[model samples]
Target chain A: MEEILSKLYYMTAFSSFTYQVAIMWFIAFLLLYLGIKKEYEPLLLVPIAFGVLLANFPGGEMGVVAAENIALEGGRYKNLFEIAHDHGIMNFLYYGLIKTGFLPPVIFMGVGALTDFGPMLRNLKLAMFGAAAQIGIFAVLLAAVLLGFTLKEAASLGIIGGADGPTAIYTTIKLAPHLLGPIAIAAYSYMALVPVIIPLVANLLMTKKEFEINMRQMDKEFPAKHTIKNIKAVKIIFPIVLGSVTAIFVPSSVPLLGMLLFGNLVKEIGVNTLRLSSAASGGIMNAATIFLGLTVGATMTSEVFLSPKTLGIIVGGFIAFAISIAGGIVAVKIYNLFAKKKINPLVGATGLSAVPMASRVANEMALKYDSTNHILQYCMASNISGVIGSAVAAGVLISFLS
Target chain B: MELFNEAVSIMIVGMLTVFFILFLIVGIGNLIIKLSNKYLPEEVVPVKATISSEPSNNTYAAIKAAIDIATKGKAQVTNITKL
Candidate 1:
């Protein structure tokens, strides 16, 4: 009877349960609630929250193991086969995909295929605001370094300001792998809150007159001197030329930006690369996202996530977000001071890589101030450029720090 | 202090590089638009010509009946013109 009771106890997880694990479960459940009930980036959050749940289960051995924990008696790391045999599946996926820094660029390929550069091409001048918004990244990097984080760790933390997940993950994996969980969480969570954040920051910086600046009316008054005649041909050539220029300037960013441009090229080519484009944006992208989210979530085991640093990242990330929006708005205000054709400051606020959501939010805010103000296309000009800007900024950080 | 200086240098360099690269793209993009416009302008497809003859009474009556049913007798068909 004593032997049987001991066996039963060993079978159950109750003996291995700890308060840290309980706390992790609460966090996981909170993420799940936000994903399901609140519909906050459910595609990513659902997979990630479920992964967190799997990792924190007592005696599961499913969470990603740290490199030190997995070190052999001889001070050598275990090979892939050995890791799979010992640490279950999540660690294997982590080492195979996420740690190798393979999936983020693959995801960027999908993003490129789905993106349209026509709006940006038409309104080329607005793209500068995208570059302006990247100030948040450097500003936060300086702040994080002042707060005692090493330059590498500060780079990873500050990249959450870029508002691009793949860029953030790619930089973090290279510079500070340990902080990947928190940085990625911060990046995606804030991206999901773009609708709320854009309005909040825009309200703070932009006045009622600025909000009511109608882009279409300005266009009518001051029409563009040069107009695109062969837009389709220009679209086909833009990605190739931009790719070459980016590769020349920032070779390090090619992994993410190059793949994005290639995806866009394949998408633009039409008929010939249709199958390839579809596979990239559809199957390959979905698989990479799943693995990326799961492995990222699995990295957030109790010992890693329950730290004062995570708190710092959360707060610093919000400041970065608010500052980036403000930076774009301020840039527009400065330009408005001199330019004859004034731009809507709301267009500047959409200068983050959240893409259409940021543009839509900015447009909605404009409509509230003036019913006829539709600036979605104008906002997209900067929004698309923001993707490139953030990627370039990430490359600059990697080149300098790593 | 060294770290702060490094951060500041990176900021200046990074922002400058980003602006330079994007500015180059804008310049090249405008050039492409101009060249394409002058050289490979959009090909205008010719529209098919339509006959100017009037519709027969049977066709006109059919059109009137269709509109009557579609509008639930609310709208009247004032005139029918052919191109």
Candidate 2:
């Protein structure tokens, strides 16, 4: 009887069963439900949910737990090998992929491969809406400062407004890795909720006339396809020029913008390197996303994630997202006041970097208001521009804050 | 107060910089479009030579059939000289 009791006591699982662990297990289940049942960004959420589950098992230590023994003498971070030896594979992945700031730039390269700059090029003026939408970042930054968070923390929290999960993750990793869990979760969750969030904001502000653009009626208004070869040449040169110009002014943006432009160049260059483009956009992207999601989720161990600051970040992020949508819509309305050939204001809501998702939401809303709107082409202009806008915002934050 | 001031500066500088960059992209992209259109103009397709459309078809078909029968379908009309 004594031997059996001792064995049970020695078992880490039996000894470590606490209410906090139970709550973490519940949180993991919640994430799984959101991913599997609701189908919200399941590609990311499912892997993240599994990582969360893997982390809470009492003695597993498969998560990126801090090295209690390794003391920071004077704010010096632990090197990769030191981190790996102390904390294991999850920590190694966290340090190598997340801390080294490698995954986000590579992910941007894949995004650039997937993107088409045609719509943005055709509707050049409309791309300004994408830049205007970034007001949410600064608005939230100010709000965070008023709430007593440090400038670095504010920057991380504010990037959630850009509506790009990877950019938010990249900024957080650079500014405040401690808040990575909450910030990443908020950014991705808001991105998935774009269909809901954008419409709610847009519906309140926009009128029926704003959603009324018929592609059939505008057949003659649109330009002919006489410049096809010219368009292709411009597409090839756009990334290289944009990357060089951005790096010249904002030197810190070079790493992220450089990779993004490189990816776009590979895709646009020609058919000779089609296989390379395919690998970057498809295989490598999916792999990086899985690793990034899992490691980010694994970092959300109970003690760090279940705090007042996490709650604050979640709330602040939502506010930022709502404001971004509003900012885009307002920008289009403002532009319409000055222009003779007015564009559908519904296209403005796509200014967030949720990509084609936000644009799709805008299109759906336009259809609801007027079935013949067909504003998708124009919306793509703003949507693609939003991707660049968010990257630029991330660059600015990093340049100024870091 | 200091944090608030920094946040203000970041907001102003960041928004201005983004707008400037995107504006440059717009300007450069448009310029490229205009230059390409000017320099690499599309070739004008030459008009097809007309040969009294209806009469040519009927006469050519008859001549083709005659040659086919004359050679027991071994020889066919390969070319016709204006002379």
Residue B10 lDDT (model 1):
90
**Tens-digit lDDT track for model 1 on A70-170?**
68787778888888998988899998898888999999999999999999999999999999888889899999999988889888888888899999999
DockQ of each: 0.56, 0.38
- Model 1, position A144: C-alpha lDDT score: 93
Residue pairs with backbone atoms closer than 3 Å in model 2 (clashes): none
**Against the unseen true structure, what C-alpha lDDT does each candidate score?**
0.90, 0.84
lDDT of candidate 2? 0.84
Weakest 10 consecutive residues of candidate 1 chain B by summed lDDT = B48-57
* TM-score of every candidate: 0.92, 0.88
- Model 1 earns a TM-score of 0.92
Q: How much DockQ does model 1 earn?
A: 0.56
